[model samples]
Target: MWPNPTIPLRIKLSGTPREIGLEHGRQLACQIRKQIEIYNTMFKETSKLDWPTVRDIANEYRVTIERLTPDIYAEIAGIANGAELDILDIVALNCRSEIALGLFSDGCSSLGWKFKDRTLLAQNWDWTASIKDNLVIMSISQQDKPAIHMVTEAGIIGKIGFNSSSVGTCLNAIRARPTDPKKLPVHVALRVCLNSTSAALAIAQLEALGSLASAQHILIADSEGPVGLELSPMGDVYLKPNDHGMICHTNHFIQNRFVDEPPWLSGSPIRLDRMRRLASALVADGETVTREALRKKIFSDTFNAPQSICCQEDPLRPLPTRSSTLFCIVMRFAPSTRPTAQIVWGKPGSGEGDVIIMP
Candidate 1:
């Protein structure tokens, strides 16, 4: 029922981890199974990872996730049970990058800007076009914390979203190597950030990752402010709005422990430079920035053809590894006005925007 104008699956679960996982598994059985199979073949061929090795790596991260947050593990277990799949399959789905290396490295182009009375965060999620069917907007309600709302792939527990607590997060995958399966993966960390009550708390959660694999930029913001933090196995970098009132990130590390690490995604530096120039031009013109302008900039495809921000399918990328811009999401968080988000179902350049209030 998900993938509707709003969310098809407006799920609300509050109970034990098993209970939550089971309900989630049952609710998304079809999509979950589909996602697992696609990832299985991709992982096997791309990373030379067998099912057993993938499982072993996932289980290792499972232990780390449980040690850090048992509730999430229980939820994952429930998903496995409900979906009628091995727990290791669910683990591998969450930790797909750990085993498959660069298989799923292409991610998003994102930023956060200070609006007059609220905070605005936006991004373009680049993923395998086949996974479009795996998209779902999940709303999770636990006992005491604020409910979490995320636009995620079926089996993945996190990607992008906000919470009733007013905290919001966005992510962009950085293609750095030497991933430490011992620490938290980006998906798990996103879930952890979703539960945070404030911006500071969300950042604290990231700071606590110790070391992480598959480096990524985690941009967080509440009504008060925004913080851009990059996490990797070696070290970390934290950034904020520039004098121009903007913080932007693409699929590369702005700063990191690995000084010489090359840009993971081919389009990363290109997009980063493009967005910076766009932001600078906006500031220099002294023009009033609106949501429309921001979206237009994100949807720009001036650079590298198929791999540009408003990406279209490429002829060179084989069918399985080929990806495109799945969606463009813009969120506004203000204490006074109910949080509102605008989403374009396909490439922002091609589709119209749909506005939804965070429930």
Candidate 2:
């Protein structure tokens, strides 16, 4: 059973794309259905569009997804078959970011610091708590790509995670776009990044896919270092680390080119500053930022109340719109060794949390 309140369900997947997706669908059918329900409510409330309309929008991306990444589409088909849900429903979940258009209040804070021995990447995934139970940790093994270990919603193929090649990524949903449905969807882009052998290769793959579907930030890091890739349908910007080898991002775009929605989350700028300050302080004395340092100094801070780094639900908003830090993950990447992660199933430093370590 999942949503245990202490630990997230962990599942291992292997073999062909369809087989892995089938096992994922079969083992977590209940969670998958629940995710649909949650997203249905969220879509209606946030996008002002009912499930049927959302499905239609999701279907528009079908041809593009299948044409660009047939293997992923096959896996999606397997998931739909195994879950006994329409393929469109599963597709909608994967395309939620594009459909929502960054209208949702959900926001996340992500940072990466490269060290002499290893690089540290971390993030606090802030969103409505309604779907907490649907969260799962997946260890996926495929024939050609590096094995992936990620924490994603039940039906999404990609999200925040690292790979056997020591490559990892963090996502910040930006509220700006003239989305090109013909391009790669956000979550699918995440899967492509996770499948890469290095940060440089990941960027190359994302570039080859053409313009991203919507506005988003993907913090990609490997043993070589971290780069903040701010992607918009209009264009792309690469945010390199500071002189100290550190970078951080929140909901809003750091660069000025792309237009963004009125600071929808409001905390976007505040959290970004706090994150940089906290992360800079840790490494100011030339101290290597460790997972513990990130967990303590960066992700746990609640500086501006409901809008702080460790975000809290704003009761002023409607129940469907309220948001909070659902989970926190910190990962370490080093040369010639498998990357590792430490996940706090609940809000980090909230005292009521279970920390899980990945293999």
Per-model TM values vs. the true structure: 0.92, 0.97
Candidate 2 lDDT over residue span 24-91, tens digit each: 88988899999888888888887789999999999988778999999999998888888888889889
For each candidate, the alpha-carbon lDDT, in order, equals 0.76, 0.88
Clash pairs detected, candidate 2: none
Which segments of model 1 are wrong by more than 4 Å? 1-10, 209-211, 300-302, 352-358
Instruction: Supply candidate 1's per-residue lDDT for 175.
Output: 64
Candidate that scores best on lDDT:
2
Cα lDDT, model 2, residue 249: 93
